[model samples]
Target: MLEHELVFALREIALLGGILGDVELSSSELGGILGISQQTASRRILELEEAGYIQRKPGVKKQLIHVTESGSERIKAEKEKYERIFEMGSRMRFSGTVISGMGEGRYYISQPGYTLHFRSALGFEPYPGTFNMQLNGAELNKLNILRNREGYTIPEFSTGDRTFGSVRFFRAEISGEPCGVVLPLRGHHKGVLEVIAGENMRQKLNLRDGDEARLTVFLDR
Candidate 1:
């Protein structure tokens, strides 16, 4: 495996470029971000472009750089490895404030395909509704950590009207109650986490909107 710092440098450059994936970076500026000399930064950029991790385009002013799909995959793989190492040594904790969802969870969780998978993988039938929570503070970072873990996959299946995308479930303990955290691979929610249990978690835990909840996720090695 390549060094993590190099992967991090690539990921940071991607983030700097935003959604358009076009970023203007000079050797000096890149050097400042990476804490290296301008010459070193220039060489690193050339090396990455040659390695097909990024593409560089000469511009009138600063050069335009875009991270390629290969670069994104490399960073993602490194993140997964990092999370595995983290989970091995520490108990992952997630903290968020209760929030409302778009009422889609009930419909989705109630689907026969999803229900069947939930029962089989999680060892319990999930409640129809999901307890949604908006991540706070560093919880968003922790959510990214959860994203890296390999979870039980609920495969996509077609219904009479439409098809539902696959969802991943990870084992978690919500306020000491065993539960499962669900993450849709393709969904609208970004910083929000949806949790499910055998019963309505709100009623079982006596939770309401604005209440803060913490979950200790047990990730498999």
Candidate 2:
């Protein structure tokens, strides 16, 4: 859905208890609340229902409306955007335990297509591998919030009949060492983060499996 529609119409419905439970209101009443005409309010409701953001059951006088799970997720995404806007210029810290990866990071990061862009955009040649981390619930939520913000983009490239997907990365520091938090545009794993640095982070930092590491991500206004 469009941003304005989500911000005004859907937000108004969610504020009217649609997110928690069913909300019964007629188009006229919704229009009065939104300061729009009854026809416009009804169209907005239809648009939301068609987009799978809401479920509506028509009644004689009012309609029983409930926000779907997808709708709740959209609202959460919008909330994250606002949070990032207000928290700009602040450093976001995430703590996680070092973990083992499936060796995919080694293969992908070693590719010349990705390595060239990583070096140019991140200002460092990656160590041909990644430092994997397993994040907790709170840290995962913070990561999700960062995902919604704009970050450095590595465009997709083709190499020898194979196509590599794009990536998004945010500049970060671990123990005051410059690094990046890499997020694959495709095949992303939940609750897991892959970090890239110029050198082997484990050796440089003397880290081991299950060691707690803190990353400080800089945010711009």
Candidate 3:
């Protein structure tokens, strides 16, 4: 797969074509599977062919299409990506300086809408407050990628007159102790990371403002 999800999708289509004995496929069939219009499907196929990721069998009455070696390499690249992700899950690392938050985490986390999902998904009751950290330049970039990563999602729901937005959680270890990273679908700051655990992290970890802390985030939980 390429860096973009759309490109990966094209590669996946080609791989499927290769699997069915390089059989001919109609635009309608491809469009149906992709939930796209037949015209769009035809355009995608043309683009894939131009990129050398797929080819139409010459002189074939049925218009057979197959994945090229280049396309197979793209799938191989996707495999390598997952491999790296798993490897990172085992021991992925990130670090930042402990910082201060708006002091609202305690209120939001204490609510049932957030707490129930936290316990169900992360397997622990988060402490009343969240430990805030400021990521360095490189770590901030990593956090951006981690934001869209697969994890547990706490859906948005209404409580009383207000509705709360959904949030995502990833199992992690802060300074080698089990914890989690919480990210709201809408966030206030880009460089900040908020952590949750069963205990007050600042006290348990003996952390203070300006102290540098590292966390090992597990992608698969």
Candidate 4:
């Protein structure tokens, strides 16, 4: 479907609760919402239904419309693309002190399953450990916003009954070195940010426990 049609028709339907359940509305009502003619709205709805993006049941003056699973997926994919476009060239700053972790970073980063994706996505093999940072007040808020944005994702994998959670990484630079900000989907650290790089960040950046670290995260490649 055309981009504008998807944005104007399918997106509006989903927002009006069509994705969760059937929504009752007439072509005139949808046209009012879309600022288009009723004839156009009616045609768009028919097109959407024919494309398998929605199921429409006709009624006397209104119709029951429900967005299909395919429609939801299309909306989600479009949303992600828009998110990336919105964040392109944007920068987020982080100021925190180096901290100790529970030694889980090494174990998780060293796994071949995770490392393979890191190499492919981030353009380098990650070191076997993560550089942990204890984020401060404002930086923690920034991290929360970053979490909502789409980034490179390492999907969940399993090995011998053990399943690993997905991880998202944003391209970043720390002290003039290329790096990545890692956020594990199943992590418990609410105020901590883990950093990964091709080399040992602690030694390369000359960082120690309680030392201040600053990172600049770029939203795009």
Candidate 5:
């Protein structure tokens, strides 16, 4: 049979953690079934395992393989991830961080009137001050941006209201980096939630919404 490369590759790497007994698949065995070389199959297994989509366990005779909760997450996330890449391919819009000569590493994000600045980097550090630095792309590529797979859902303290499908990032104006993303409330909410980041962010990184803070979201299930 023609292999279902993507799905099979995913499953081959991570076994379905069944409700009953433990079952594990070795790369050599799965490789033969999928018509891929053992090394290729083994690499794939490692990749999936590293990505947190699957896990391996030891049994008396064989290793146990199973899909983790994160596996479902990857299945859902791949769609959004591909969509973002496709959008970038179609129209080259990107989000980059800008830096100012300030001693501290601060970035800004904003909506129409308000802005906010929180010192962070999901990890990477920003220069003292710069404008719109590109994300992890080639030097020739002017746009720097990162796409996160999972979005957050946070409930408001005052009301039972929840903000669904969230993404966070910083933007700077010193080098023309656009500010963070803007998205509306999803599903249960009657109307869209308009987020206004505070003004302190505006002064630090230099941000404006329509000009830089453009983003989209998928409603919560």
Candidate 6:
């Protein structure tokens, strides 16, 4: 992998944001941020334009540099690469507020307030307005901390449980009160589920396809 590609891509985009508005950059400012000489910065800008990462508006007096869609895609791809490296390990970082929980089930808010339901810890309150956030733990641990170590736990996993129409345990934030917590989802169809309860008892809370649900997983024993 190109170790410096991501870093360079970010720096290039940062420079483009400011330049997009203005006609051009003072050699000193660009060089200062890049820690290179003015000549070097100018050369790199030309190279970026040639590579299609940016556009140069032809003008007699001054040249204007702007970030292109390709540049934005490069930045996005780099971020995904870095994120995947961190996610596959036990070093998952959680950033969101715990909204609500009951009996040790916690739900976190990461998307807008409209979107809830996540794999989180248990134990929290109905934190409605603030951006209550907690980080520092493996992905699962970060979620569980919201339950505040309440009676939230997982049993062993089984092949039969992996099938449909069954009750199973998963760690997810249903409410923000307890940020990282466990909530149960009823498996009715494959990869589709219903929250254990709806507005009325004895009914299943069906979820939409592509909806996000956090699964609390345990080892098969």
Ranking by TM-score: 3, 1, 4, 2, 5, 6
Better of 3 and 5 by lDDT: 3
| CA error at residue 4 for candidate 1, angstroms | 31
lDDT for each residue of candidate 3 in 89-200, tens digit (9 for 90 to 100): 4546678999988998898898898899778766777888999889987778778778768778888989887998988888888876788888888856568888888898
Instruction: For each of the candidates, give the backbone clash count.
Output: 0, 0, 1, 0, 14, 37
Write candidate 1's Cα lDDT for 12-113 as tens digits: 798797225779889899999989889988888887887788888987899999888888788778777678665653457777899888898899899998
- The TM-score values for the models, in the order shown, are 0.58, 0.57, 0.59, 0.58, 0.35, 0.35
How many backbone collisions does model 3 have? 1
Task: Report the number of the highest-lDDT candidate.
Answer: 4
Residue-wise C-alpha lDDT for candidate 6, range 1-221, written one tens digit per residue: 24363348335555567334434655455667778788876777767766676666755655666676776666667678688555533323243322222322112221222122222322232233222122223444544432233333443233432422212333332321123322333222221112221121111223332333342222111
| Distance from true location, Cα of 193 in model 1, Å | 0.7
- For each candidate, the alpha-carbon lDDT, in order, equals 0.81, 0.83, 0.78, 0.85, 0.41, 0.39
In model 5, which runs have C-alpha deviations exceeding 4 angstroms?
1-8, 11-24, 33-35, 43-51, 58-63, 85-93, 101-221
Model 3 TM = 0.59
Q: Comparing 2 and 5 by TM-score, which wins?
A: 2
Question: How does candidate 2 fare on TM-score?
Answer: 0.57
Kindly list the per-residue Cα lDDT of model 4 for residues 1-221, writing each as its tens digit: 47677556999999999989999989899999988899988888989888788998877768999999999988888887678656644877788999988899999888888888778867888988899899987768888777877788788899996998898888888988888888877756568988889899989988899999998787664
Q: Which stretches of candidate 2 lie over 4 Å from their true place?
A: 1-90
- Estimate the TM-score for candidate 4: 0.58
Which 10 consecutive residues of model 1 have the lowest summed lDDT?
A: 84-93
lDDT (Cα, 0-100) at 214 in candidate 6: 41
CA lDDT, candidate 6, residue 58: 55
A best-first ranking of the candidates according to their lDDT comes to 4, 2, 1, 3, 5, 6
